[model samples]
Structures are given as structure tokens and as C-alpha cells.
Target: MRTRRTRAATAGIGAAALAAAASGAVLPATSAAEPARQQPPPGCETDCEKVFDLSLPYDVRFTGWRDDSAPGGRSVLAYYIGDELHDSRELPDRGVQDAECGWDGDAQRCAVTYYTGAHSTGALSALLTADRGIEETDSVRGGAPGATLRQLDGNGRPDVALRQSTYDPNYADAPRYWETYLEFEGKFVRTGCGAPEQQPSPAPTEPLYGSCAYY
Candidate 1:
């Protein structure tokens, strides 16, 4: 009777263990903890300036910095939406000349113009939406003075117009104009629709306004 009672107790313990396993109440002896995620380095900590701001039903801000910690000063542009960082771009030069943000149709467009030395300049533009975030970015070899939006293709959505200038050593006094038109089908694409007219004889140093010839 003692042996029978001992066997009954052992069987009851086994049943309890099986029930715990079926109910997912059993745990392993050890578990590996997940690693923490790493974040990108901060864009600016000191010598920061608030360069651009726009209220498109949301708080949008653009801040910049001229970081001198490196060999040469680094130009940094950080974009924020509703106090949260959304995007950033960096350039190694004299710093940004201009930064602007505006609404273009259903998307919000932001642009930055930075000096590239020798009186030459470059621009960076981005297209973003409130829900989808940044959709695309374009780099152009020009200043932001002539950047504009127009309905070039008649697609109901506005297209982007970027202007650039070319100078000839012989005609240093005059600069030739070039315009790039970008249309959005699914993404921003060069339409190659607007080509500048032939440079007039003895081009004027001042900007010559003309129409684009669509090919």
C-alpha cells in the first residue's frame, strides 16, 4: 500500500506538469534580452540658429549650424515637424545662404541654398507630405532665387522649375540661363520639356527673361 500510494503521488505530479505545459504556464530557465536600438548623431548642439519656419497646419522648423569642431566648418540643416526631427542634410562650405518651406499643391516643399565657393552656389530641395513623410529630394547646380512652381504639363498638379546659369570666359560679363522642369508622375522626374533659347548675341550681364520651348 505504501508503494501504491507513492506511485499515485508521482502520477498526480506528472499530470500537473502536462496541464501547465498545455496552458503555456511553463517558462524556460533563461531568456535573451533584446538589444537596444541606436540613434543617429545630433545635428547641432551649439552655435545653432533657427533659419526657417512654416505653419502648414503643423509646426515646421528648419535649424542650421556652422560646426567648427572639424577641420573646416560643417554646414548642417535639420528639419523638424511638430518638434520632431524629420530630415537633415549636411554640406562642407561657407554655410547655407537661404532656406525656405512652402506648400506646393498637396505636398510641402523645402529648399536650401548653400555657397560652394567662388561665387558659385548649389541647392537642395525636398518634397514631403504630412502623413507620408519626405517623398523625394533634388539637388540642383544653382541658387534658390529662381525656384518656382507652375502647372507646366497641365496635370492639375504644379511642377518644379529650377534655374541655373552658365558663364563663358569670353562673355564673362553675360551669363546664359538654363531651366530644369520636374514633373511628378509617381515620383519627381525630369520632363525635359523646357529648354532655354539660344543665347542672344552679346548676352546681357543682367538676367534675360524668356519663355521655354517645349520639345
Candidate 2:
């Protein structure tokens, strides 16, 4: 993950200029204009903080907050275009535990992870583009640790690989590890290509085709 630094500009005149003005000294006039200050969206006026920001290629920002006043402390993910709110989505969990954003080929992608309770976790993945705007591409409710991008098939584009776990009462001593692969065909769709139990390793070494059972 790359971290970009944002420089905040001071809005007022310099201390030396203020002192010179107070001393009744003539000062040279300047026509330079101050850079526009970025402001948070109206929805974030109360309690919100920007968790992620990307300035390259496009100006994208993610603002998140947990509404303590609301029941169960509802979580929100707000999308921004240079501080101006483009849209916002309500998260299924309480708050965002982690967030990641970067370019996936020509599209900009983001994944947000959150905990539902003490024992369970969930994730939300979003895709941003010029024509489609920002769209929620995928979501996992429980037992999702994280997501990664990979080339699982012959397609040149990258696919989304989600790591998940499930518990079976019959196999109480062992938890089953499962993976969900999503391919972008106009939009994101399940490929049904990953089965951790069937493979000798956690992930398949070769490209997967069709269904895991058949392949």
C-alpha cells in the first residue's frame, strides 16, 4: 500500500507581514491567490473522518464514521470527489476496521473490512470508473479475512479472490477454508473456480477453468 501525503496551506498572512503592517510600514502588493481549501461533505459535518484518499489518475476519497448515537452504531462509507460528496453507502457492520484502495488496470478499486462482532468479520468491495461512477462490486457477510487481486483464468484482467472460512457442526475440530473468485465480465460475477478442500494447496497453482468440481 502506498501512502500519499497531503500538504495543508496556511490561510493567513505571514507573521512578518503582520508585524510590518502593525509598525505602519509600506508593504508591496501581491496578486497571488490562495489555493482552495477542501471541505468535508455535508453528511460528515458531525462525526466523520477520511480514512482513504487517492489523488493520481483521479481524485478519490473515502470517509467513514460510526454513528454512536444510532442503534448498533451504524457504519457509513462516503465517496468523495475532491472533498465534494459524490455518494455514500451504509456498511453492514458497525465500523470500518481496515480499508485499501488502488488502481486495478484501468479501474480504481477499494475494499473495506469491518467486524460484525467479537468473533466474525465482513468485507465490502467497490469499483470506480468514469462511466460507471462508484459501484459496490462485491460483499462478504461473515468469516471473510480479506481479499486479493489475481489472474485466476485466461482473461488478462485481474480477478478478485476472497478468503473465507466456515464452520460445520459435524467437523467441530476443523474449520473449512473456502475461496470465492469473482471475474469482471462487464460486471463482477462468481467464477466458482476455487475450492480449498479439493486442492492440495490453499490456492490453485494453474489457471482454473469452469467449476472447481469439474476442473
Task: Please tell me which predicted candidate would have the highest lDDT against the true structure.
Answer: 2
Q: Over the stretch 108-130, how does candidate 2's per-residue lDDT look in tens digits?
A: 56656566654455556776554
- For 41-119, candidate 1 gives per-residue lDDT tens digits of 1555565444433333233444445555555455765544544556655566545655544445434465555555444
Q: How much RMSD separates candidate 1 from the native structure?
A: 21.3
Q: Which portions of model 2 miss their true places by more than 4 Å?
A: 1-38, 47-49, 63-71, 92-94, 98-109, 129-133, 144-159, 170-173, 186-188, 191-215
Global lDDT of each candidate? 0.44, 0.48
> Local error of candidate 2 at 113, Å?
3.4
Report RMSD for candidate 2.
14.8
Q: For candidate 2, give the lDDT of residue 10.
A: 28
Worst 10 residues of 1 by lDDT: 1-10
